[model samples]
Target: MTSPTGEPARTRGPEGPDAPANPLTRLPLDELRRRTSMKWRTYPPDVLPLWVAEMDVPVPPPVARAITDALALGDTGYPAGTVYAEALDAFARERWDWDGVVAERTAIVPDVMLGIVEVLKLVTDPGATVVVNSPVYPPFYAFVEHMDRKVAEAPLDPYGRIDFAALEITFQEAAAGGRRAAYLLCSPHNPTGTVHSRAELAAVAQLADEYGIRVVADEIHAPLVLRGARFVPYLSVPGAESGFSLMSASKAWNLAGLKAALAVAGPGAAADLARMPEEVSHGPSHLGVIAHTAGLREGGAWLDALLAGLDENRTLLADLLADELPQVRHIAPQATYLAWLDCRDLGLGDDPAARFLDRGRVALNSGTAFGTGGAGHVRINLATSPEVIKEAVRRMAASLG
Candidate 1:
């Protein structure tokens, strides 16, 4: 396959001596400041904004062309057809070797979070308990509660992987009174880039089966897995046929503004997925389907380039943090561009992000908002140029002095 621009969509090998030129570094600071996205507009000009998960890199050429074509033809109606699902099926087969996903078993929703909320509603009634891994995406707390559901916390281990022992305890507690519950699983977990192993996920499926709990996985960051790490979809595991998974090209290809994501149903949950209200399908934007499909079908080479750039930035961040601020410890993430830092030793108190923003003029996500294990932690986006990562750390170090 070739990109819209006719460039061959070659799958580049892992990052090594022959890595291509860094596309991230090509975007200048002045150009970035002109962006109207939340990352740029959320802070003052002098404050380096690295808090949001948005990437600073330009999108793949094919995605841009697809969007432009939609506008030119005035094809911005409600989304229809199975193009997005078909593209995802192709990408998954080649990328993950998972064939459980078929276009017929998927539905396009506005985005991953909303898709997850809808799936949760299908499994649990209002006021039922919903289990989540804390220090997770903050929206997990808000959206679940918004649905009139109760949330139970299963905090991750010290190493940032899921605490299954603790999770079993929480699941048992939540399952009392015959209350239906669901687990909001974040594979290639956010805040901390812990790409869950296949065994761990199978164990979760086993626990869910034993407890009669439904599992809803948010896999938005699956496509962004860095080198030395692999992402496993929750439904791909054996005994996971009852689970639901949500994925999108938004995070990997920077198409969040386009507003489209897929909610996939395992074989066992086909009836629940088919029962999803028809009105829910109308929420996805037509242009989003076109752009996302193009991304999945023709943007492999571009994605490979992006993973290479992020790989470099991840290493640069570790080196910079060690040289400039050894007190702030970061475990180099295995998947997403996010870096969860242990800032407690910095003597910055419970909320280090607040101090960093006020004193260092660098904005970061406050760990407290992520719940439980989040205190004394901050999530940083490392999806930008190495220069930006270095400068952000430099400014942070100077804040202490």
Candidate 2:
């Protein structure tokens, strides 16, 4: 099977009489519990945590070796050069047939959210409005507001695609009073896992251009796009040459702790990117750059295996919800390992995740935190073992009884 891009489909891992192992299955609950990441430590020992975006897999060998080698040589200083951007360019070219990422037009930042804040700073003033499609990643509001920028939401359409009419209205309002505005786009949207089609993104670029709004995109989950959907980098679209993008291997490779990300500027936005403070580049850890560079350059096979596992998990989750909790509406995600479940039918008003955490002992992200159109829903992380997913469903069902 082939994807729309003509690349061989990654719906399943390498298959033979002896297939390559799935990464999600490699770590058991006992082993996972021994680690002390936020996903594991935020709740009690008894609770099943499916809330955070952290994956339940070990570090990919290539990334691990790179970080270890760096430490062995005591190469832990400030990050230097454009190696991270170069590696990402290679990955994008191979995986998405994109050649827009020039190392000279990219900057190293601490991570995706911080990178976004820094890029937003480049395009708009502190008091300007930053328009977003909600319910979006929670930090889109938090970080923008923290920087004294106001957030104006243009909620997604019912099927989780961009609502162009609402967006246009929001854009008009955001640009009112002759205020400089920016649009923060989350491609392959969080929680919903809705991968924006190229047409949709092109339309966005057109609208931003019409509204005199600058665009900044968070493309951190680009590599985690599953079998069916293709990730369209915002900067690759026409009329988007003035846009900015934030890319990272943290989510795809589960290296969030290492803390490295890139801020990529489209050709027309190169001058804006150049205006970014030199101190911002100092924020990324040297080890993080090495780890992310290695992952982007050499971890393709591991990523494919992980995506295959996530594809299975996506289907498994839908089936489990259908059989065990018929009231829950599960839209199988097109990308990422997150599943957004609509539980309004269960009579678990506004925040179903709270009820699930309390009664089911299952920790999930509350939809309310994601802003407008988010109530009565919950986001579940499916990057764990199938056994854990099954247990979580059983507990959730039992809670209703």
lDDT of 2 by residue, 339-369 (tens): 9888999998999898889999999999999
Cand. 1 Cα-lDDT: 0.88
**Candidate 1 lDDT by residue in tens digits, 1-401:** 54222323334444677654566787888999999999999899999999998898887789989989889998888888899999999999888878877877898899999999899888999899999998899999999999999989999999888899999999999899888899999988998998888788999999999999999999999888777766678899989999999999999988889899999999999888998888889988888889899999998878888888888888888888889999988778878889999999999999999888999999999999999999999999988888888889988998998
How do all models score by TM-score?
0.95, 0.97
List the global CA lDDT of all models: 0.88, 0.91
> After superposition, which runs of candidate 2 have C-alpha atoms over 4 Å from their true positions?
1-13, 16-20
Residue pairs with backbone atoms closer than 3 Å in model 2 (clashes): none
Provide backbone clash counts, one per model. 0, 0
